[model samples]
Target: MADKPTVTIIGLGSMGQALASAYLEAGHRTTVWNRTPAKADDLVARGATRAATVSDAVWASDLVVLCVLDYAAVDELLAPNADVLKDRVVVNLTNGRPDQARRTGEWATAQGAEYLDGGIMAIPSMIGTPEAFILYSGSRTAFERYEAALRVLAEPKFVGTDAGLAALNDLALLSGMYGTLAGARHATALVGPERAAEFTTSLLIPWLQAMANILAPSSAEREAGDREAGDLPSEESPLDMQAAGLANIIEASRSAGVGVDLLTHLLTPMRDIIAAGEGDVLTDLVEVIGKEIRS
Candidate 1:
């Protein structure tokens, strides 16, 4: 087998430090740099080389990972180091928009470097665990070259060649997570906090696990903007029944002195669709939203 590649981590935030630690633990030569030099002290103590500057960090490794604040910070750190970036592979795990990823990919390519935009799907604590997986897009060759090294951080998922694909899917996954959390919060509010722990553990977890298993595949299709009307399953739960249940939920929440904002946010558009005489099932809303997005 080939020798492990040296890895350079360009940010020392919690996530950046985790990445550096994983690399160091895997016995890769790890170099780390942060704007505030003090942040790298712990990692340096763990056998990581602390680079004095961002350019020096880039120069230390063929695989340079960036987990900085944003695209602006990424650009600020990288622009000055462009000369040294040639032939190197840059993996940016920063949170950013799809367009920003595309633009950054272009900029990196112009600098004669291979760019792979990354979407980290786990928290810092989850890095290096089986539960953590990262999405990558752009420069398939670069990804293939460093796939083994990258897996030291998390399972690597290559989404596509479009630089923005990773960011797009990342935001989509986060949207699902926030939506799930909102519903869970509303459910907990329906029960008092005293009961939340038991409710979530005994009822909510299994219920949601089953629902997710049933819904996730279809949700994936809708999210990809590829769902056609015919692709929707036969109406298992009609909107009329759903609307009645939702109305009852709203009434109960109001009676319990709980806010109905989240429920109403769903019900209002739902009622509008039903009133507009354009929808019969809940999934119909997907078509309407798709059209709105297209327009």
Candidate 2:
């Protein structure tokens, strides 16, 4: 078999280690560096080379992958070695905001390195597996050049040319996930801990999945600019009725000695939409949210 391309990984955190391991397992010459050199012990034993310094790591390979704590840490580590980064393709898988990713991309460009901001959707254990997927944006040329190597880690999804695009989508997806988590916690609290496990497995998971399926078409309607055209029949429960149902949830939680905070917070926006006289169609809530975001 042909030897794989060499890859350098900075930051030996769990995710970073997973990345290096994936590359190594794919037969790439993997060079790894971390602030705590001892963290690379196991990787070194696994045939990964340990770089003596951050600059050495950058110099080790043309494809440098960074999976650090944040954008700040990324800057702190790479800023001094900017000169060494020239002609390298630096792929940052750091978790950060869109603006931060854009700024870092600019900095990398200034140092003559091609930049691609990436968002890993899977956890460490899923690395190198088909279950893992990664979102990437910016430096399309670089992405195409190294995409084969990247696919060794996970499925590479090139989102757009904008450096911030991956981060934006990443945060948006995570926001949806956290919202579901909050809803699950509220549901479990109302049910009591004793039955929460069974409730989640047998009921909550399936119900939430069904609810998601229902919302999918509504989302498509909104995207297609059919907000004025109610996705559901007018005979269906209106926004006001939905708000009342939320109110009932809050009351029931309070009565059951469970915290009503999540339900209360959720209802606030629905009430705001109603007060703004935009609750005629259920999808009007989307417009209300867009307005609030713009304001």
TM-score of each model, paired residue for residue:
0.91, 0.90
Cα-based RMSD of candidate 2: 3.1
RMSD of each: 3.9, 3.1
At residue 127, give the lDDT of candidate 2: 99
Question: Model 2: runs farther than 4 Å from truth?
Answer: 1-3, 218-235, 291-295
lDDT of 1 by residue, 1-295 (tens): 1399999999989999899999988999999999999999999998999988888899999899999999999989988888998999999999999999999999999999999999999999999999999999999999999999999999999999999999999999999899889899989999989999999999999998887765545765678776543444437767777788999999999998889987786676667778877778767757545655665
Local error of candidate 2 at residue 55 (angstroms): 0.4
lDDT per residue (tens digit) for residues 1-295 in model 2: 1556789999989899999999888889999999999999999999999999999999999799999998889989998998998999999999999999999999999999999999999899999999999999999999999999999989999999899999999998898899899989989989999999999999999999886766545655668775444244343667888889889998898899988876675577778888887665566656655765776
Cα lDDT of candidate 1 equals 0.89
Residue 154 miss distance in model 1 (angstroms): 1.0
Tell me how far the alpha carbon of residue 80 in candidate 2 is from the true structure, in angstroms, after superposition.
Answer: 0.4
Mind sharing the TM-score for model 2? 0.90
Candidate-wise lDDT, in order: 0.89, 0.88
